[model samples]
Target chain A: MATAEERSRLRDVPIPAIGGVRWLLGLVVPALLVVVWHLLVTTGVFAAHQLPEPLRVVGTLYAMGVAGDLWGHVAITLQRVFFGVLLGVAVGTGLGTLTGLSGLASDLLDPLLQSLKNIPSLAWVPLFLLWFGIGEGAKVLLIAVGAFFPVYLNLSTGIGEVSEDLLEVAEVYDLGRVEALRTVVFPAALPSLLVGIRGGVGLAWMFVVAAELIAASQGIGFLLSDGRVLARPDVIVGSILLFAFLGNLSDLAVKGVQRRVVDW
Target chain B: MADAPSEPTLSVRGLTKRYGDTVALADVDLAVRGGEFVAVVGPSGCGKSTLLRVLSGLEDRFEGRAAVDGDDVREGGSDAVGMVFQEPRLLPWTDVRGNVAVGLPADVDAADPDARARIDELIRIVGLGGFAERRPAELSGGMKQRVSLARGLAYDPSVLLLDEPFSALDRLTKHEQQDHLSDACAERGTTVVLVTHDVEEAAYLADRVVVLGDQPGRVETVVDVDADRPRERTDEDLLAVRARIVEALGV
Candidate 1:
């Protein structure tokens, strides 16, 4: 049989730059909102008491920054988020990996975890305040509770989603159970674990705000709550902006870690 | 034919595999001497892959005796065997070098000078020297399979098993892999057992080609190529052998 010996390129055309354009389009709505907000406040369409001018909010932020209270609130909130996320991820990941590896273990704990997940983190505020007495423990525990489910569930799903062939690869290499868990399974589940961490980070922020509102503390949430009691709408608006800024910062941090660690 | 002498490198006797009521392979006996390259070709559902899976000890539910160098194939034990499946099956997270290096015994000095040296040499031998840091996602199908071959040969096994390793590639890439594999096997005198649906590939690569018939697979015929190493496709004798194997498939 006659055969052609030349190597063939099986139509691997490069993807178009259309995807980048679509990404740029994602910025439109947020930009429009900021523009409209500034226009409405500047035009006096909304009372200053109801909606502070953007410049006034910025000025308030500047004053807070000069007094160093902005930094303090941000630092304390971040500290709570950091420790809470760490503790939650550690326990959740361990439980999740165990559940994923054994059906019986998953069956045993999935229901309890699922039930706890259903109760919003706010529901635990009063109980947490009663137990830990509105201190750092209550706040941190509340954030930990919020972060736990996402990390646990995502880690479990990630471990469960691991390819059977990949497991076979480890087996063919004669990797022991522990070695396989560490090298093969852990790496395989990392993308989902990062997704889980992202979810957990977002939830931790939500709980931090709720905890600050219910108790005596210093944080961006505390700043927002203090604005309400003092009837200073400018501080409330400033604190909300601060929360948005820090939330975005935490998300960026998570993304950075994902890139550095997962390399995906 | 009085015992055709010398110890067999691999032997299968009264091997039987069944998937519930459907019998895959039954009462089969096969043998290969050291350094012999045997190719098995069969129809779609003829249990060709099952046989390789059995040999690799991936599927052990089958009733059979498969011995490699006089040792029964056992699960989770390091034997002198390696396998390349149809897919490259590279770990998406690991780079080319790490993927190939995983084949070496885990206890081997991964951080040592000797292991690193051997890994570099194998990468070069597979013509993938510059692509070591590339992830599997960044590689072509052909390059990925080359990494797969490098992974299989990294361990220096007594016998290498391939299950349609290049069947997924384009025709030209398939031919290149066949040529590369043939040369590598000849250079090392490695015992090879390959299973494929393509009769032409079997004829070109095997010292002995075994044809298997339809379901509940059994050997129909065994043809000895007896052609010189590095045989060209244009050679009349090689073409004749290829024709005979294709005709035996009754296609």
Candidate 2:
């Protein structure tokens, strides 16, 4: 046999370019929305106190940034979401692995978790506040509760749905149950785990807002509520825009990691 | 190590498999000596793969004995065989080197600086030497199957079971992989049992071709290809043997 070999080397697949056109294209709608908002305010379609001019909102945020006050609020909120997502992911992974690998454990735990999944993030507020006394503990734990479900659900389903063919290969290779789970099952379930983490981060942002409502004094959420209390529409709109930007940034970071880690 | 000199490396006798009322295989029997290459070929639904499944310990519910080196392997504790399935089944999270290392013995340090050389050698044996860093998604279908083959060989198994492993490859790629497999098995002196549907593939690669009949698949005939190594595919004697295998298929 002529062992003359042909290696049909695959050139690297260019990752779908998240390039200038796509970036600029995404800006079109939000830019248009700001233009419409300027028109709505300048035309006096809505009263100034009710809906601030778009520039006024931008000016308020700029002023806050120059004063070095915006950083404190953004920093605290980011911290809360970070820790909450970490806690949520750690606990969710533990539980998801258990239920995913064992039918008896799934039967024992899945129903109760599924039922509690419906209890809105706000619904946990009363219980958490009463238990932890409206401190950072309560605030962070509330955000964790919100982040937990997506990780739990996605990871459980991902692990459970690991391909049987791969498992069969593990068996034929004589990978014992534990070794198979570690080598094959966990790696196979990683894409879904990452997807879950992305959702969990987004949820962390939402629940941080609810969490800061429990008497926070220095977060973007607190800024929004304070703006509402003092009736500063510009500050309120500025805070909302800040939330959108930070939440999207965090989501993009997780997605970037997903792309790299699950390249196959 | 304690085996009698007369014992076969892999043997299956009276092996029958069923799913409730549907019989997948019935009364199949075969034995392969060490370092031998055997291919089981038949029409679809002829349980060609079922025999492999039983031997690889994936179909443990079957009746009769599937043994490796004179010990029953059906009880699920056997570490004597490595199997390549129809699909690559590579872990998408890993590279070719890592996927092959997944089949290494549990004690072998796949992460060790020393063990990487052996893993790299396995990759080369499968014709994927330069592609070690490539991910499964970056590979062509034939390359992916080669990675799967490398993974099966990484176990350093006494017997290798392959279930239509090249069925998904193009004809030319399949031919190349068969030669790669033949060379690798020869180099390692490993026994091999392949299940395939292509008569030409069986004739070209296997020392013996076991033809199976359909519906409650049972062995029809086992044709010996008494040809030498590196035999020409178009050689008159090889063609005559190929004709015998096709005729045995009753087609």
Candidate 3:
């Protein structure tokens, strides 16, 4: 207790030793994969038509950016995802909270949602195209439908799993229904809600790709389709890479929000 | 100090609770006057917690007449009672101040200067003045329980129900909490009903100790402590009362 060095160590918060090195370590695998890809292309392991060189894909990405096409497509796709996720979160959270809190609501709604969520997202594309006519509505609805189930399922499960002890505390405090929902139920279910949002965001990205594949004028999904028709592997590969990057970025954003909101 | 006679702050008569075929409590009666400190001590299965729950109006299915200051316990709202559970049961997401402030009425403005001052006072009373910004996860078990006690007192309840509030703590911390609770309640003149298994705790803190027996839990005996406050733990009279409680517990 009297040691100066030990006291200083205790007073100073120890920085994680691996923090800086871990970022470098993480790049190693991707770097190795890119190297292998370049080698395969240089050695002509696959035909040029089948697989474009990595440099060609980079050239295509640069050209798209110069033409302002990349930003336009990215913006449209992001808009669709944003609105779809917002709508899905609102509806799913509302319904999930209702069903979670009320036995009668659960009895009436759970079986239908359970059955509906099983249908693949692609299965709805035909109906959505027919209903909304390949417009913004069809694409947004598809993503929303894809995003709704996970948020609903996880939120309901999380709410149902709130500790009985805490619920008793709410009772003792005589918290009104809304007050309890805001203060007790919401915080208790936040971690699960964040998990649900993460799942929903992933599905939203996937659904956007599917939605664009069916019919779209401007989007990364349209790039994939246009590349297939024109036999340009570069565009296809570049679009796929952009999707991966954006998806990672969106998921990272969700994680950042989760860290800030659900500290416990 | 003559005043108009008033009803007991907490009263339960012929309280009976059953879960299907199992009776948790049967034909139990208890009364606690305003500012009185009563401790309920008994064996593990003696339904001490159930009684507290009934008195706190959390358990409504019990067949009994339980009231706080002439109002039916169930009808009296948050102002009637505050309860501290065995576990701290603080919202882990909230800091100490937020947790304690949750005990206040919803209509109260959290940002009001007076409200903030009262919250600070309660936190100081519980000896958590410096830790108001700490989350429950950041605190030790004893500290968390202190926050829980502060939250209970924040309501300024006429009757405070404690269900083994210090049972999870170590011996030293438990005694410390006991003293803190006694002082806090004495300062506020709030009636308290504490449920615990420790005979010594019951003897040291309670003005009256009610012993209960198991099987369909019922009151076994009630012992009154005539000793003064701040009495030493080793005081002969307190020890004798503790011994009688231990004997009543059939230990």
Candidate 2 per-residue C-alpha lDDT over B63-160 given as tens digits, one digit per residue, 9 for 90 to 100:
88889987888654257888888888898877899899988987888888767888998788777889999989999988898899888888888798
- lDDT per residue for candidate 3 within B1-251, as digits (tens), equals 24324556777889999878889899999878889999999988788888888888777687978878777877863348889888899999989999998888667776788889999998987778899999999999888888888788777777898888887678877777788889889998988999988888889999999999976999999999988888889889999999899988898
**C-alpha TM-score for every candidate:** 0.87, 0.90, 0.91
The top-ranked prediction according to TM-score is 3
Q: Clashing pairs in model 1?
A: none
- Angstrom error of the Cα, residue B189, model 3: value is 2.9
State the lDDT of candidate 1 residue by residue for B75-106, as single tens digits: 43226777887788888888888888877776
**Poorest 10 consecutive residues by lDDT, candidate 1 chain A:** A1-10
lDDT of 2 by residue, A133-177 (tens): 877888889888888899999999999999998898788877789
Error at A65, model 3, angstroms: 2.1
Evaluate model 1: give its lDDT: 0.83
Candidate number of the best lDDT: 3
For model 3, what is the C-alpha lDDT against the true structure?
Answer: 0.88
In model 3, the clashing pairs are none
Q: Each candidate's chain A: what TM-score?
A: 0.87, 0.91, 0.92
lDDT of 1 by residue, A1-264 (tens): 122322233223323545557777778997888789889988889888888877888899999899987899889998999889998888888998889888999999988998989998889999998899978887888898888889999999899989888787676666669878877889998888888999999999999999988785698899999999888889998988888888889999999999998874
Estimate, for each residue in A91-189, the C-alpha lDDT of model 3 and write its tens digit. 889988888888899999999999999998889999999989988998998999988999999999899999998988888877778888888998899
